[model samples]
Target: MARSSAGPAVAGLTAGALAIVGFLAFQASATAPDHPTQARGDSHSSAPGNGGKKKSPSSTKVPADSGTGRRVVYQLESRRVWLVGADERTIRTYPVAPSSVDPDPGAYAVTSRNMSLVGSDGVQVEHVIVFHQEDGIVFGFSAALDGSLPNPKARKKTGAVRQTRPDGKALWDFALIDTKVVVVR
Candidate 1:
């Protein structure tokens, strides 16, 4: 009687395959979001995580003249940013720390993005979304790794609009490359 070697080979292959699949599954779960339900834009919905409730009285409204359709509205005067969905509803709006060198009030698109980098101010920042560049100054939005705001007293010409870590994540998720960005006074 000849012993079949194919059985041991097949079992080994199966074990290796299962190990790879288990590892992949673990990796996916580790990076997955805690909340499984993603928010979709609709006329009745009031931003993600709101559960379709109306915006609170304290929440700032998107400017009337911030341009229509999906766009990021940066209010230079108010130092705020509004992420407007295609439905013209404000998905998220939050305050930002303006940079010393402000970009001209105009329309632009997100040119590039970096996950992490050392900011010009010598601070570690993340979620950098570059939109406009003028002269030699690069304008973008980022959040400090330490959750610190930009130093207004710094004399360097940097156009880094700083936001909180959570806000940075939201903006990172909303504004992608080529997304319209409108700057208004």
Candidate 2:
């Protein structure tokens, strides 16, 4: 009787341990950033912005060799944007909250800009920079004046790359009509 009881207890412990391990694995994958957008070995640092707030730092070099002139580089996988100056130097680099709908990796030009307006998603936005459009959905960069980064609605089609208010201001000042915007994987 003792031997039979010990066998069942051992089996139970093994099953419990397996379950725990499986749960942990699931959590790890879920927390990991979507693999398609993982940074490609680029070094990043955290630096303070003009407002004394910590800003996401990016490497001085562009994420990819998309072109040779001044442009805005948006790394889809890293979810970072770099404002490259005329001399091929990075003017500023910061993090952005990208939409589920990603623009293809290529070069685009800024078609328009708005100082303030209501986004298609109905959010009050400022410094809207229009870069591309697909089907009927327009894609651009904008920031909420209130400094909020709300989650996109599951059923809404949105392609707004969101930044902090200060970052938005910087982008607005930098990206002008016909400014080259490079989208990179």
RMSD of 1: 14.4
Q: Measured by TM-score, how close is model 1 to the native structure?
A: 0.70
Q: Per-residue CA lDDT of candidate 2, range 84-162, in tens?
A: 8778766766677776577888899999999999887677899999999988878899987645453555477788888
TM-score of each: 0.70, 0.67
Ten residues in a row with the worst lDDT in model 1? 29-38
Query: What value of lDDT does candidate 1 attain over all alpha carbons?
Result: 0.77
Which of the numbered candidates is closest to the native, going by highest lDDT?
Answer: 1
List of clashing residue pairs for candidate 2: 37-77
lDDT of 2: 0.72
Q: Give the poorly placed runs of model 1, Cα more than 4 Å off.
A: 1-59
